[model samples]
Target: MGLEKFGKCLSMAAWMSLLVVYAYAEGSSRKWRNEVLKQVNSKGPYIGLITVFPPEETAFFGTGAFKPSPIHSSLDLSGRRFRIGKVHDKKVIYVRCGVGMVNAAAATQQMVDLFEIVGIIHFGIAGNINASMSIGDITIPKQFAHTGIWDWVNQNGTLDSNDTVAHLDFETYNVPKGGHNILGQIRYIHEEFFSVSGEPNIARPLFWLEVNQEWLHVATKLERMELEQCINKSLCLPKKPKLVVGLRGTTANIFVDNAAYRDFLFHSFHVASTDMESAAVVMTSVSNGIPVIVIRGLSDKAGGQSGQNAIKTFGPLAARNAAKAVLQFLKQLN
Candidate 1:
């Protein structure tokens, strides 16, 4: 053989070996998929998913730089690929679906096009309602009320039929084949009180429905009971994520600005927390048939600080907790 041919063959062998080594390095499970597997394992199927905004002020889903694909062909509807993951567990993925409705919808479609996610949870922070919710209270919302969609319902108790709404009742929405698991509650953390006249915080949960099935059948009936119990009991405790899970509130537009507007939301919706991205995440996740959960942390009261400051204090912490919750949920599902 020619000297040049032998050299080329040697290079090819060296490259292949490097590729094999890279796949097994430390923290190798960071990406989805692994050594191929055929027969279904004893563990449950994979559950592909995505998260929007989360606890950071970052945005995604609208950047023209990285558009998502129509669905990774290797994975099944359960979000499992033939040879993915070191443990053959419920494979999952996350997306920074940006804030608001438009971005969230785009990300949801991308997730669905790429994998078979069984459930979704829109998790994030929210403002306070009625001065009743304190910091670190987990609220599972049953409805999402967007003030932009309609007039603000007053705490004074005057029902106005003319109220238009950018918001939708999450509990009323239909979920797909598996239906989202016990989506009636939203987790929340209350912003701290700095002054004698500090602004009231607004915190709420995300709302969404299913694209394939009308309800998630896997949620044990006891799930609802457990969540509600946690919320009722959390009020007396002093901890982040008070664990109360039932009938949370949601909004459409960003309302963390003025005291009047904030108070209006508080009295009107009777919500306990508020944030910017959950509703969009919920709406889109439902439309695309991907189940998602949102976990938000209270960063500031409407006029508290610059965007930079807000992220600095709570951004990393919230993201860490949200990631942990998702991993725990995935383990429970499997």
Candidate 2:
């Protein structure tokens, strides 16, 4: 009886030891899967392409031969669809990031996590803030700034309002007198302030996000290439669109159709164009340490034009031109 009891105790000890080993192995496997397995499973190094709206998405898709992949995010609460394939012989993943900063950031983060993307490229239509820029003209901004963050200041430069400020101050690249006609060096102010508190109690440092120089070089080269000059016969532009590099881009949730605000943004931020999504993408990419570039085609003159809203008429044209530029850039990358 003593020997039998001893044997039973030994069997129980072995079973418990096996259970412990199995549990440890399972935990390690999960860890490895999370850290390394997805990377190995990824069909990359991919170039991520983002467009903001349906028209922009249509324009981008028209530029390349993309094959729909079975891969999709099971956790995509936004229900945004992702497509993967090739553009100019380089692997590409194309997705629509919706129409604003929140959507852009969410989609970008998902892309970075889901794929082994080497870089991100955002292309779409923007309201032209530069008076010299015409409809169909492409602007590849050197830096992106979130213009929504502002501290309401009095005429004396004191915080007039008691609003909470998220950013105490930030600096942006200043476009020169000659415009971003060349790949000029970026400049930033010493300090600028943004209010985070209604009581003017708190503020944080905000920095302008810079585009990857290597990608910027590619964009500069694209300026020399001829792009689609016409959208369609009905909406034919007076002149062929031209590409310009080194502009500053700004983003806000507001659709800046007001001429006064358009001029204000241009004068204050030295921005060539304003859009809704690029700034978010830039911030997201910066946080992830990924290289990114933004290519925008002028669809309208903000509120500078008095006759009618040009976006309704020229949006597709601008999107197509931007797409053409992006495709050319991808070709050069190959």
Candidate 3:
């Protein structure tokens, strides 16, 4: 009987110990989160600039032909390097957010949570959805949407009596109802395995974040400024690239190289450009109530004859144009 009582007491003590550990962990987590929040919100109203990778990063803020200045560096919680400096006399923090939606979203969230950023600007090369838009042309999207989220419906066994479907079959979730900008309204359908680890495979909302109107005005004005037409004498272009603003843009994980898909997205979303990161950045910005804009230079027409080859050949030129436009916009901000 004494042994039995001792065993019960030991179990209770163990349970209590576990409770203490759990409480400590919870408290530590909350404290850490609060500290991060404090740090991010305490910083000055700095602009956040994001590029997909190193080349684009080099184009925007690196020590290359368009030498800007010595950029200050810091590491975020994720160990991603952030370059802090003044662009056109305006305070800015630039980061290469890697490539694709996941990287973009994570980096954006870190920027929002760890810095007092007033707005976000994403400058990178993108595949042009608008046939009229040529390589090296800069595009400032009015809004951004996630083209990757889709709903797949099986209609193989749901045929009509006459073996012909009466209504449209296999409908896709292109644009979320009531528009994609409304938070919590847009639902995403995804395969179970495709869901991010630790995140449930539940319906997620698609966000169509709009660029700030004031920023858009500034961007529009920058169009009148002289832009670089050539990277060098040997790399001269056939025509001087122009800045096109107020067009729609979309983002997805896939690098679209199919003409049919490109045309479909262009017509369906009324978008002029497609990239792998812009929409995710926009969504994160909108969720945090910060204004954001995407400045994309066309490295290639989506599924053009040159295809992905154009990205390598004209990518640096396009990135330079984008950087020029961004600088012009920053100057206007000042």
Alpha-carbon lDDT, every model: 0.43, 0.77, 0.74
TM of each candidate vs. truth: 0.49, 0.72, 0.72
Off by over 4 Å in 2: 1-40, 69-78, 153-157, 160-204
Report the number of clashing residue pairs per model: 71, 16, 2
Which structure among the candidates has the greatest lDDT?
Answer: 2
Q: Candidate 1, which ten residues in sequence have the lowest lDDT sum?
A: 221-230
Better of 1 and 2 by TM-score: 2
Tens-digit per-residue lDDT, 32-76, candidate 3? 757754653455578988889877877776533232234324544
CA-only RMSD, every prediction = 17.5, 12.0, 10.0
For model 3, the stretches where C-alpha displacement exceeds 4 angstroms are 1-43, 62-72, 155-207, 306-308
Candidate 3 lDDT (Cα, whole model)?
0.74
Error of 3 at 122 (Å): 1.2
Candidate 2 deviates by what RMSD? 12.0
Ranking of all predicted structures according to lDDT, beginning with the best and ending with the worst: 2, 3, 1
